[model samples]
Target: MIFFYIFLLLFPHQICQAEVNSNMEGKLLNDLLKDYNKMSRPVKNLSSPLEVTINIGTFESFDLDEISQTISVLLYITVSWVDKFLTWNPEEYSGINQTRLPAGQIWIPDLQLQHTPIGSGMLSTESNAILDSSGLVKHTPPGTIKTICQEMDLYKFPYDTQTCTIEHLSFTHPSNELFLRLGDFTLDQNTFQSQEWQLLNVTSRIEINYYGGPYPFQKHIICLMVKRIPNYYISNMIYPYAVLASVAGLGFTLPPDSADKLSLGVSVLLSTTFYAGMVADIVPVTTSMPFLGLYCLVMMSLVAFSVVSTLAVINLHNRGEAKMSYLQKTIFLKFLPSLLFMEKKSKPSQVQRNTNHKGKVQVETLNDSSKEVEQEQAKDWKFAAKVLNEFCMIIFSAGFFIIFAYTIFFL
Candidate 1:
């Protein structure tokens, strides 16, 4: 008897379920549908506009295609409206509070994105609507759509901020019939995160405009402002350029007599042009050049300057003492060396001897020996070449530093 009582205590709910009718849910659905169908046109016949509130459920993906200047996104959209006819008191319906029905069975707002990119159709998944006791109908539909919005100001490209808009409108219904508005918040905070982008903010507004059609329409535009995460760009784009710039700067320090000095400069210039082509392919083809592009041009110009300066130094080094002009000796040997803070080459010690009354010998040190001074003067071309190398190193170093600092720190 105790065993029987224990089994009954554990299995009472299962036994009761077997006795209940399986058709209760179906009966409730049938009753709800019958009442829902009786209300003619659900609020279309009413004088007041139907206020539809929309919220984004999930921001699945956001991508910017720089070449095409388009943004592709995958979004889960939620739209809610109050339908007076679709209501039923939960007390009257066997404790049934809410139910899910096929979306086709209910009247839905014909909302769609108007500025989608070409060849990219609006994709909507088969979804359902939730009908509550107080007649609140909520439908969340998932869509993967590409939008066409151009980001022209790419001056800070690879570190740029872009705003892409998703504009929605009712296709067949006019503004009087369907009024659209944003919900409390446009994006779901928990689901709105990106890997390559920082989702800055989302703004929403409604605009009434006529699209050359008979009736004017209302558009709900949701603008997403995002800044690109620069980690990838820094490593792949700017870092390599920095390394190449350093190599180009090193050319200024190489001896002018080196056979490879000019060759090195030419190689660096060609490399910059190649990188520019790559950047052109990635960024939008616009008349306004970006800072990165300007950086490339400036670097290439400096490299060309280095090459030309190398040639001039080589010519100066090859000129004989008899052929060297007075201006060349003054500028390249005296003024240029002083301007560049180059130390003069070492010279041999000068000796001066004096004989006194007791035949004592004394020696005094002059500045330098006359022979050594003359020899140093004879090698004016060598001194000039050294001056050129030092001068270029100082000037190009400053130029490279200023350009890099301004572009990186200010921008």
Candidate 2:
């Protein structure tokens, strides 16, 4: 009986020892699984050292207004990825440790990504995704993967920097507005709502390449889009037009008797005409009138006035008769003379008498010499007329050439 009891006690001890060994093994396996889960977690470290490259593609612009004040841009981006290094491996684990480890997986979750402009301007778009397209993967495990993100936004400026250059910027007179769309990892959809965005200044498209995996085992391509905002100066449509019209209006200030009137008027007219043609050449012809067109028309009217006034002055001098008619003697001679002397003279009697006699002599001399002076003035006027005619011819020729060249080349 003592022998049987000893046997039973030894068997219980062995069973207990076996259970303790099993428990220890379970604990070790659990620890290894915890480590694997920690290592396989996705993209928690953005600032981790990475190998990256970027390439940009063609950009296109669209006008949303008649004046070309508002515009939109389309851009293409291409990115390439290289080899990447991963730190932890599921294959390294053995036996029960493998079962305990969470499924070997890595994924980026809830990534708050944005393409920020380091230079200047605000993007005019909703922070949403529009199109997300990916290309085919080449290699097998831990291979190259490329991702494309697209977005549209409005931009405005006083640019903060001048480092990067964007191609195909469109602009027009009176308003300088711009539009653009860009993206990196996320896509923007229905972002072009008018009420949500204001005018923009500039736009940028960018591309980024990512290298990941065990020191050098994977590659990825990321595309980024950016748009810049600009501050705009708003004024009346008539302000610029009025300023140009006033340049032609200066011809009216010339004295009627001055021989330079015709030359001055013709010169002003030609210059204004050239400016008008320049404006016309740059803009498309439309049924609707432009502020610049209004300005040119106003200037032409003033030129017409100058031409008529010159003709009238010449006609009046050509009729060189000084025989004081009732109208001329009564109104011009008598009334004009009385008006000048109505105020008392601040001079001695002798000086006053001399002044009166001088006035009489001057009037008589004017009557005698009027025809000769008229003939001399007429010659000066004729020279002016010839100069004006020549100027008009030159202007016409220049305008014709400009029109012809524009049609042949630009049109």
Model 1: pairs clashing at backbone N, Cα or C within 3 Å: none
The TM-score, computed over Cα atoms with residue i paired to residue i, of candidate 1 is: 0.77
Per-residue error for 25 in candidate 2, Å, reads 33
Query: How high is the CA lDDT of each candidate model?
Result: 0.75, 0.35
Off by over 4 Å in 2: 1-72, 75-253, 322-411
TM-score of 2: 0.29
lDDT of 2 by residue, 1-411 (tens): 999888778798777767765775456445433434323222235344322222334333322222322223353333222212222233332222212111123111111123222222221222211111121111111211111122211111111111222331111100111111232432333333332133233334433222332222221223223332222211222233334434434444554457875676576667667766755663444455543454455555555555555555445434443333476445433453354332212322222222464465322223335565555545444433334333433443454344334322342
TM-score list, all predictions: 0.77, 0.29
* Candidate 1 residue lDDT tens string, 16-127: 6644423555666787777466324468467777878887656867888877777877776788888877777776665677888776677777777776766434324378
> Clashes in each model (backbone N, CA, C under 3 Å)?
0, 33
Residue 206 Cα positional deviation in candidate 2, in Å, after optimal superposition: 29
Stretches > 4 Å off in candidate 1: 1-22, 27-41, 44-47, 58-60, 84-93, 118-125, 186-190, 212-216, 325-338, 341-378
